[model samples]
Target: MVARGRVLVIEEVPSQETFALWDGVRAEGWDVTAAPLAATVDAVRRAAPDVVVLNLHGAGDADRRALYLQAAGRLALTRTPRRPPILLVGDAGPDEKPLGVADVIRGPYSARHVAQRIGSLSRLSTMQQEMMRRVETAGQYGVVPPELEPSNQFHEPKVLVVGAGIRYFAIERTLARRATLVGAFTVDTALDYLERQAFDCVVLNMRVQEAAEFTARLRRNVDHFALPVVVLADPREVDEVDAAYAAGADDVVFHSGESAIFAERVATVLKEHRLRESLKAAYARSRDRATNDALTGLFARGFLLDHLSRMVEAAAHGGRLSIVGFRIANIDEVNRQHGYAAGDHLIRQVGTVIGRLVRGEDLAARPGGGRFVIVLPDTHVDDAAGVAARLGAVLRATRFALPGASEPVSAEVVSAVADRIDGDDAESLVARVTL
Candidate 1:
């Protein structure tokens, strides 16, 4: 299996608690490393972690501050193009908030929650690095990338509160200062609100089962798949917390009635969500007609080659690049049974499914006919194969309607995965998978 990302834990004294935390994070599919505070600088340079976790559990105020600064400074000095974010795994005073820290997990926290935060930070770091590389490649083709101008206008985040009683009031009061709050007493009402207006985050102030069900429902919708969902649950119900994460809750906060802490956690999740939205917009704006397939709105064949070439060159420096190639095996059959127009319609629907399934950073291209390729940067061949499987499953599940067909037709998608070899170029890399 492909690891989520690499994480380095910097702790002065190792304890059973810390060891358990490492085991849990590792179980979550992350590569975790433990190092002492004295070796912080060298450990980071040597490990080149995607995120750094600082254990400040038993440290005093001064000690905590010093450790945080030292870790952040050493990470800044590291010569890697992608600098890791610091995740403080203990109490952080109000005054201890620093500029490079991704988040601070205070009070009694679960290992699963910490792992989720690490995964978020790691993905953000990777997206930033990918953006930089894509910009350079676009420039090479004389295609000017979109300028991400700093906006002077500030909009308050809109938050939806789904629950009832005192918790709803507490959430309203907590977010009133920082956001605009809308309350929904029932699941149907919450779904209605979601369809009508946009929200930065959804706070489920209900029972664990209800919250999990609502979360799963939101995830099924394409528009709301990436929207952040925070579940407020009773600390005593440990199994419910696991179920929440399993149902796709972004963060599960045990209800402690601490309004300030809840507000801060919600803010942290919102910040990451907005940052991802900005990056996605930049990716969309960076594309032009010359680079995109007109019918499918995917990357064109020529642009795919150019981008793949740059990715292959970068792989020499140390990184993984894999391609998932797909072909609609029955396109010609569909054309013969129906007409050329029906074939085109089927192709368009397939493209739409592929576009929805891929990550923002993954480049999906329609290289013409029934062939499609998805370039997965920093992805291993095994992971690439998993992606291909998902695409195939979804395509096979979908039934395309034709102009003169008695019944809806299902797609037969054939897929192959190829990782870049030592002597592979853009043409050879794509051919290995597609051909």
Candidate 2:
């Protein structure tokens, strides 16, 4: 189990309330601090909180958010290349105004909610810092060697709670069986020590209201963080998980419904980048086989439709578009005289000629046994026709010499107008040009 780290609470509440919340966090094995919300910036810089919780009930909630954004933007520790998780505690408006903390809590925070939020935000911050450290230590190559990996690799994903009273001890054993557990404190020395450590993810199990407020405070800090965050929400409103992400929660899982998914979900996110690389390689190979012809270097007819459709979605405004179709005129005669190999050689040459004459965006593909289509994006019909005419000239000029050939082979190029398409869809545009 990983250790719980320091947590700083900046609340506009009574000292006793702060103490109570402070006690709950401490019971969870955390070094907790209850400072005035106004002094949050200095305290955080001085003490450097793993997680900072703010109360909108404090003076100038709005200003705090703005100042925090600016202050956090410059803080070298918080602004490290990797980002931390933030908690905001507040109500949802058209915009969840920044309370200057990473996470926010809605008004009427509960002790349980505050405790959970603290736990989650702290771990997430730790994870964010870990990723940054990893990326930095690897330098330009960006690979974490085995030595580096084992030296200070983060613990397996799990929630770590600070303070002890909140049943943090029991959960520690439970989490350790399947996940890594962590602990820390808000006291200056303890906070300093934990700052050097790392974790995989964070979960804040605060009361619904405190979770909201804590989430609001956490928003800025985690805005740039990539670590996964799960808010401990009541099963009743589990559907509000979507709202959580919209406000900056990486993830939200109800303890009642999601006990099974916690460990698995954490592992998936931590490994997401590697999985993406694997999937991308597989997809590229499959796509190449489907789109490219083996014998001739031209794309297949089916490939044209698929690629054109995709390109249309990303086409530039007022870009030119053109399409050309050409017939082999007398492919059978040449096949009969020479052989299949010679025929293939001629096709390859024609594909090469078309490829050389066109731009990178242009598509040259064999539509059928003896037909070809050239799709030219960002081109006018007249311009495409002119290019086709030039290509026809190239075909006539090039003597496609066969192994035993005495003369050169030529092709008849036919082109039609498809200038200035009204619709953006690929099929309709191709139809207009083909017709």
Candidate 3:
């Protein structure tokens, strides 16, 4: 089994009580290192402890508290990219708060209290390291893309934790106890993960360095904006809580030391997210059924005509628009020779070819049986004629294999072109090309 985690104990001068606390922490299965307060900077570099326990009971005056805080700041500066959580064992006067510290316990406490705090912090650290290891390993090999399916209800919720701090990883551990965690080391990595995977909720710790910036960044990204974010706020820092809301946090989870609360908050957000996704998927399916043809997978005739009206209106306002119309002359012959299924195969093949030739913004539709139309935006009459000519040539040159036939059938295509005129409506423009 792996060691639980490492702890660094810092003291101005080692006392009997401090040694006793560390002894208890060690018995709990942690790698404990005791160093004088003056040598903390060096000892942190060597041991790389996950939790730093600061012993300040020896300080008898306010000046000593100031010095201890200064020393804590120096230790923070020594670690780059990621700083360990600091657990202070000292008494704080009113209006006294140490920056970047995780927790504080007053003097004259038992060794068990210190051990409890260290255990919690160490467990969180181990969770972070383990989750990050899984992420980096996946990045090396790669993950298969999720299947495209209509989601009607909640699946297993994949939660993303967006920092390496104590509460952030603790939330990861909490959620992992109930669900699997999709971990990320920074906001950028989280954004990348969101693009590559489907997640139900996100938990962000505002205490991490540059966390506020990352939250804003996540909000600005279009792909990640709708993702539900649960901000873990420090109950004492009112400004941070407000900032999290201003940055578009969907929910806030205050640090209350209860893991169950964290897990429940994530579950609630996940339910909401699943509902939103279900509505979106249902809307898309309904829209596609209304607008698309059942056989050819192209836009339906009525929808295409309505869209052509909009294109014509835009062309009247100084934009260019062209239409290419084509009809397969041998479609009836093929149907009679083989069957109706062969005719459908021909139409689908023609639709696929047109789809391949058109630009992403161009629209392809079948206004009637064997008659196809392509609306090309920002195009002149010359270009439209060129597209029509290309369609005719391709249809004649390519032989399509019909179902249960020994030989392939060559299609004969008759094509026409139309450009938007000064006095033209959707019906007139479409008639000029089709008739």
TM-scores of the candidates in the order shown: 0.85, 0.32, 0.35
Q: What shift in Å separates residue 221 of candidate 2 from its native position after superposition?
A: 61
For each of the candidates, the C-alpha root-mean-square deviation to the true structure, in angstroms, is 3.5, 24.5, 24.4
Clashing pairs in 3: none
Superior by lDDT: candidate 1 or candidate 3: 1
Rank list by lDDT: 1, 3, 2
Predictions ranked by TM-score, top down? 1, 3, 2
Cα lDDT of model 1 by residue, 109-194, tens digit: 77787888887777667667777877877777788888664211288888999988787887888889999999999888999999
Better of 1 and 3 by TM-score: 1
Q: Which candidate has the top score in TM-score? A: 1
C-alpha lDDT values of all predictions: 0.79, 0.51, 0.65
**Runs off by more than 4 Å, candidate 1:** 58-61, 149-153, 312-330, 378-435
Candidate 3: tens digits of C-alpha lDDT, residues 1-435: 223456788877677866777787677556788787778778877776778877777655778767778877787667443368787776664234487566665533344435555644543343333233323322333432222243434356677887776665677667776676877877678878988987777888657225556666665543455567877766665435445544556556557676665565566556545544543333233335556677777767876777777678756654567888888888899889899999899888887666545433456788878888888665557656765764566566677887956698877888889888779887787777773
Whose lDDT is greatest here?
1
Worst 10 residues of 3 by lDDT: 137-146
